[model samples]
Target chain A: MGRTSDAKERILSAAQALIELRGYSALGVAEICKAAGVPKGSFYYFFNSKEDLALAVIDEHWAGQRGNWQRILGDDDPPLQRLRRLFEATEADQRAGQQSCGTVSGCLFGNLTLEMSNQTEALRERLQQIFEAQVDMVEEVVAAARERGEVTVADTREAARSVVAQLEGQVLFAKLYNNTRRLDALWTNCLALLGAASPGRAQEAPVAPAR
Target chain B: MGRTSDAKERILSAAQALIELRGYSALGVAEICKAAGVPKGSFYYFFNSKEDLALAVIDEHWAGQRGNWQRILGDDDPPLQRLRRLFEATEADQRAGQQSCGTVSGCLFGNLTLEMSNQTEALRERLQQIFEAQVDMVEEVVAAARERGEVTVADTREAARSVVAQLEGQVLFAKLYNNTRRLDALWTNCLALLGAASPGRAQEAPVAPAR
Candidate 1:
């Protein structure tokens, strides 16, 4: 049982890494298996198909990141500050990814959605559920900020969607340009969208993750 | 010569359609040829390779859309109104696309960038050039708006890039949701970003193209 679980974890990690780097359709099961150091039979035994593995990848990836998100957005700081910290953390992640891979991979959900939304109904629905959940989290943050008068917006839901879209879009730009500065620009714009005063460039460093 | 040009046009159109609907890496030369009803030999005769054909598709697709952008952004209307008209036209185009294909196919440049930027350097550079050109046009409009005291922004270039990013990002959402209403929300948020007043939802129709 221990050995079997180890192989499953390896396959999930390998799929997440490769999918993040290349995309959904570009990478094959063979490459994923090779990267995971697992046999083909084990792959099928663990997951029914590549699509099933992708779904697991999404869930597993989000599961690992959800804690970071909850900690960042659920901080005791002012809502606006918490939002800034969340983006700062994102910038740090992108920078780390660039240093490791020579390219920023952007959001896995966004990448898969762009590549496979129209091609695969099951994958698209799964991604939509994940994004909707993320957007809800953003909405909650924005709503709290609005209640406290830290943020001003006519519609909190729309504002949240805009914030999420801006983040995804800027990440896409960073990946395309292979530069992290685009993320800083995105942060600045995000500040403006939230009706918060620009704190200048002094806040580019990633805040330490909450304990 | 006429027959040769006809075949070339057909191939370019088909490639654009397939690439926009799917993505760069997911579609192939043979599939494009089959869609265009052009023989494989004719496809090669018209373009050197699939990459060359992709470049041509970008060029041709932009050629078809540039006139609309110029007409909308270059109109005699106020800068804010012109910008609104530009977005409204974009929404109309997205709506039409959704109606025709039952899905929102986001911006071709953005879709390609996300899919192929890391894998294909030539294609990435070509896309960068095209995006830069588009950004230049946006900067011109934004600079003009700033000069006229219509749109107040700290930096014209950043504002223009933000606008482009927002447009690309929202289209991505529209594509992901398979819905056109996201475009409306994007326009509303864009107004907020530009510090323009919400002219409300009455202006959903495509503004008349400049004569």
Candidate 2:
């Protein structure tokens, strides 16, 4: 049974990697089957259609992020520290692995929404709901800072949403320009927003009080 | 001669609308040909290839923005006021039209870059040059604020690039959600970045204390 599931896991990972670069429309079943090194007969054994393949890609991507957030947020460090650490980790990860583009750029879910989400309202809602869940992950951290009396926000929920929005946008531009530095700017700005939205997020900056 | 040029204009406009929604790769030449009601031979006459057609669409879009800036930016109002006014105008325009998703969501240049720009350095550079040109336009406004004793920045050029980045990020999220409200949040955050980056810009804020 474990061996049976290994093929499915490999197929999902291969699809995630390909979908990030080529987009959902351009990625064909044949290409995925070839990339996964699975037979065409075996491809149908798991997914119902290309759409099913895409959802699996999104789900697998989501599943990975779940583990990622757990590590970043659960660290022993302070809330602000953990937040910055996550940003740095994201920058490093995006640059090293795959080297195709930003972790968030050309996301299979994003590509699906742009290309065919409207035609598939269920998929659209699912993507939106999933993305919102990611936003909530950030909100949890922001709220923790608030509890610690380390952060203040115009609206914690909105701030978290904005952070994710900026991160998502940064991914698109970074990939568009093929520069990892773009991701860095986004990381900086997100930190700025977190600080500015809070009372004092600039502990590292050494604020000199007005004389 | 005028009639011939208008037909060409109509063809280009139709192609732009379709391409933005579906992306350059998935947008069939035949589909564009059908939507524009231009014969395939006529398309060949106007554009040597689909890439050429895409290039023309980009040229047209840029030309339209130039004209738009002239009308809105050159209004008798001060530049800062004109800037806010233009934002309102853009917001209205998109709501009434295709939701201006310009350079925000699925930008044609951005979309094409992800799909084919990597295949050629010349094409990549062309697209990069175009993005830089867009950034330069926004820089003019930031520069004006600086000169008028109304803006300060650690780096105006960096600030300009970040503004472009923020706008790019926001638009993608906006289109992803199919909600203009999300887009407005991005615009608000962008202006806030401007405010934070330049001491000079803060005084121009609606509620800032007079200098």
Candidate 3:
């Protein structure tokens, strides 16, 4: 049982790394199994198909990412500051990815959305749920900030969407140019989108993440 | 000569359609050739390899899109209004795509940026140049707006990048949700990002294009 479960974990890890490196469509189960150092039978024993494997990968990635997001957004710092820390963490994450991979792999969800959304209804639905959840998390922070009068927006939901959209867009550019510095504008852009009082570069000093 | 050129155009159209429907990686030369209704010999005569075909497709799409952008951005309207029209056109284009294809196909360049950028240097450079051109055109309008004191952005280039980033990001959402209405927030978001004085949803009433 231990060995069997270990094979599943290895396959998942290898699949995730390959997906981040290339993308979903170009990947094959045989290649994934080869990379995972498992046999072909192990793949079918675990995943019914490549799409099923992709769904698993998406769920696993979101589980970890959601945890990070919940921690950052649910922290005790000022609401706006928490949002800022979220952007900083995102940039840091991309930078770390670039350092290890020699290129920005970008948001796996965004990459999969562009590559696979139109081809599979299942993927489309899964990606939609993930993005909706992301926006929901951001909206919570925006709502809190609005309550404290840190930002001025009539629709916290739309404001959150714009902020999240900006992050995805800048990350897209970062991946395209292989330059993570492109994301440095996220905090200032976020403040501007929310109509924060100090929506100037002068106010965009990076803050240490609390916890 | 005319027949040969016609075959090349056919291949490009089919490849673009397939790329939009699926993506570059999952596609094969024979599949593209079959969809194009062209002989394999014709495909080889016109393009060197799959990557070459992709580059040609990128160039052809950019050629057409650049013309539209120049016409919209270089029009004799208020700079901000031109920007607004660009957003409207983008939304309308997505809507049109959804009507015909039953899904929002999204910006072809953006779709490729997320899919192919990390895998191919040629594609990465081409996409980077395309985005840089987009930013340049937007920066021109933004600089004009700044000169007229209509927008209050200190760095026109960075501001333009942010605007384009917002665009790509929102388009990412629009594609993922398969809803073009997701883009209606673009003009308002743009106004906010540029720090325009009247940045409110009430001010986002759609305006007809000035040709």
Candidate 4:
């Protein structure tokens, strides 16, 4: 059972990486199995089809992301400060991806939504649910900020949606230009969207990681 | 020669439609030819490869969009009003797409950028160039608005980028949810981003088309 679980984990990780780098349509189950070094039998044992594996991958990916959001947005810092830290962490992750992959891959959910939303109803429905959950998380943070007087928003739900959209849009540009600098404006713009004060140029700079 | 040109036009139109619905990676040359009702031999006669055809499709699609933006954003209205009209036109188009296709397909450029930016450098470069031109158009409108004191923005270039990102991001949500109503807040948010006044909700609603 332990070995069985390990095989399943390997398949999911490999699928996520390939899908992130290339996209959902450009990959196939055979390639996924090859990348995972799992035999055909194990692949079938783990997933019924490519679509099934993709669904699992989406769930797994969101679970990890949900944890990250909870940690950053649910932190003990001021609500606005937590918002700032959330975007800073995103930029850091994209930079790390660029260093490893030679290009920044944008959000997997956004990528899949663009590629598969019209092609597969099942995938689209799953992606929509994931996005709604994400938006809910952002709305919670925005509501908290509003209650704390950290920002003034007429509608927290719309503000939260805008935050997700802005982040995804900027990340799309980063990938399109193959330049991480495109993301430098995200933190400031996010605050501006929330009617918060500018964090000052010095603090807006992407923090260099300690070696 | 006329017949040959007709076949080429058909191929490009078919490719664009299929790609917009399904995405760039899922459709193939054979499928594009079939949808166009052109033979495989004729497909190669007009374009060298799928990549070549895709380039032509991107150029053709952008040419049409460039015309729309110029007419709407370049009209003889106040700069701010022109900006509002531009987004209003976008909402109208997306709504039309929903009525026809039963789903809202977001910006083709943005959708392709998410899918192909990492896999193909040539396509990425083309998309980046097209986006730069689009941004330049927005910057010109923004600079004009600034000169007229229609709005105050610290950086016109960044402001234009934000507009594009925000619009693309919202359209992405519309596509993801298959809900055109997700776009209801675009014009208002756009005005807010520009530091301009809301046009009031009644006017903000997409203007009904004249018969």
Candidate 5:
């Protein structure tokens, strides 16, 4: 039993790394098993198919990410500050990823959404649920900000969606240009999206556009 | 001569549709050729490899999209209104795509960036140029808006990047949810991002947050 569980762990870790490095449709079970250092039979024993393995990877990634999000968003900081922390944390994470991988891997969910969502109903549904949950989490913070009169947006849900969308979009650019600095604009952009006045240094920099 | 050019056009069209419906990696030369109803010989006659074909697709799509963007952004409307028109055109495009294909096939460049940027330098460079051109076009309009005191953004380039990012992000949601309605928020979000006081009826809606 111990050995069997160990093999499963190895496969999951290897699959997740490979999926992040490349993508789902480009991967094969044989390549995943080879990278995992497990035999072909071990793969079938653990996953019914490559899609099954992808679902496991998605769930595992979201579990960790959701925990991080909840901690940051649910903290004791003022609602807007908490949102700032979320953006800061996101940039830090992307920077760290670039350091380790030599290139930003981008949001796994966003990557998969573009690559595999339309190809598989299972992935599409799972990605939809995950994004909805993300929007829900952001909406909670925006709602809190609204109650405190920090934000003037009429629709917290739409505001939250736009914020998340901005994050994904900036991350997409970061990955494309291989630059984490692309993420630096998130906090200011977030504040603007919610119509809240910037608190310090006005977080809203009005420097001349980069020539 | 006409027959040869016709075959190439067919291959390009088929590849773009397939790339939009699925993605680049999951496709094979033979499959694209089969879908084009052209012989595999015709494919190799026009393109060297799948990567080459992808570059052609990217270039071809950009050629047409760039023309549309120039027309809309260069129109005689107020700078902000041109921006508004761009967003509305985008939403209408997505809606038409959803209606025709039963799913919202997102921005082809964005979809490819998330799916292929890290895997290929050639693709990364091409996608970077495409996005930069997009930002340049938007920055022109934004600078015009700034000169008119229509927006308070500090950096027109950064503001433009954020705007493009928002568009990519919203389109991702539109594709993931398979719903074009997700794009309806683009114009409102654009005004917020630019810090421009929305004109007429105040595009800033302080309505109740969606439940």
Candidate 6:
């Protein structure tokens, strides 16, 4: 890649890490620049403003996710299994140090929305577009799930929406509680909502199960 | 109350609104002072730091949630019914024009854990305690569901945990998607999970007239 492209990628990656690490709100432009090993000029050289940088960071962040997310959501398995695999992959990322946990992303996007939703129609539209894209992506999987007979749910669309909500809530809890176990449980419930039980879902005797 | 005390309340309320409406990140002390109609010197006189003010904001926000939430979660009704009511309340809040839906609290508590979980040990412990407290609160009702035969699930504790994950997930989805509809579906599915199926639930659907 060209030097300019490398600098841009460096800035974006730094933003992702810090945003994931310290959050967009907590971390300042100086910190981002320090993390990226780039000068302030390079930062503003590429992005017009802090909000612009944040927007770019969000764009770059999700743009990177689309392909990985699609791969898992669009794998060779049945739609339901593909969905589970996608979550399992997410769980793996959470475990293997891929923070950002879209669940926690509300702090930035929703935070920005609160600050600018009134003043910046452009940002609001951008946020809406990103989220709609997510819902649509999920809707595609739910439609596939219906075709696959994996779930006899009454409404695939609503089910898809709930799955998104469920996944997002789990991320927040995981962050709050600093435990990934909820991720497992939430993913299991996702499958359950789609008519598939989580692995080892049945509760044993409240006492001990005799081996 | 003294004028200083009144200023504190104004600062707290202003901070709460701004944190929920704007964000906790660098919402300048000046902006808050302006919003609260308090003098800058008076603001500094009340709180030690912006974060100190933020903690107070969270406390106040939590207090505001108490009456409404207690009514929904701790009512003189079935645990399942109470649960559904809580979800319905979220729907009402969103439709009523408050953009700051608790669906995604941007959960100040959770957000702190995410940003500071790495740097500060005391904050880490505090965040864990908060989550445990909330989880315990929810588990109380989940335990009732177990005793009353409302929930046919095997393990009430696990069932309760599963429910919490869904609730948190719905919050994130609501905010990320900027809509409360998913929160509504989350309530419906949660009710179903607890075995309180209505006309919407598949199992509760009346048998088709002998076609």
Q: List the residue pairs that clash in candidate 2.
A: A152-A198, A169-B169, B150-B200, B151-B200, B151-B201, B152-B198
Model 3 global lDDT (CA atoms, 0 to 1): 0.87
Candidate 5 reaches a DockQ of: 0.62
Q: Supply the TM-score for candidate 1.
A: 0.90
Which residue pairs in candidate 1 have backbone atoms (N, alpha carbon, C) closer than 3 angstroms, thus clashing? none
Question: Candidate 1: deviation at residue A58, Å?
Answer: 1.0
For residues A142-183, what per-residue lDDT tens digits would candidate 3 score against the true structure? 889878877777788888888899999999999998988888
lDDT of 1 at B197: 25
Residues B1-211, model 3: lDDT tens digits? 6899999999999999999989999999999999999999999999999999999999999999999999999999999999999999999999999999999989999999999999999999999999999999999999898789787777778888988998999999889989898898888788877777443432231111111
Ranking of all candidate structures by their TM-score, best first:
5, 3, 4, 1, 2, 6
Q: What is the DockQ of each candidate?
A: 0.32, 0.28, 0.46, 0.38, 0.62, 0.34
RMSD of 3: 4.2
Ranking by DockQ: 5, 3, 4, 6, 1, 2
Give the range of the ten consecutive residues with the poorest summed lDDT in model 1 chain A: A202-211
Candidate 3's DockQ is 0.46
lDDT of 6 at B199: 40
Question: Which digits, one per residue and each the tens of the lDDT, describe model 6 over residues B1-211?
Answer: 6787888988887887666555556589999999999999988887887866766665666566666777677878988777777777766665553444433333455445544554445555555666665666666887787787555455555556566656655655555445656565655566544443234452332111111
Residue pairs in clash, model 4: none
lDDT of 4 by residue, B1-211 (tens): 6889999999999999888898888889999999999999999998999989989999999999999998988888988778778878888888898888788888989999999988888899999999988889888998898788665556778878877888888889888877777766666555545554333321122111111
Can you write out model 2's per-residue Cα lDDT over A1-211, one digit (the tens) per residue? Answer: 6755777877888888777666667778888888988887778889999888777777777788778877997777877777777767766666764354433244445455555543455667778887788788788887787678665444677767767766665555665666656666654566544544343332222111111
TM-score of chain A of each: 0.90, 0.81, 0.93, 0.89, 0.94, 0.78
- Model 4 alpha-carbon drift over 4 Å, by segment: A197-211, B197-211
- Which residue pairs show collisions in model 6? A168-B169, A169-B168, A169-B169, B103-B171
Give interface RMSD, per candidate. 8.4, 7.2, 6.4, 7.4, 3.1, 7.2
Q: What TM-score would you report for chain A in candidate 1? A: 0.90
Docking class of 6: acceptable
**lDDT winner, 1 or 5:** 5
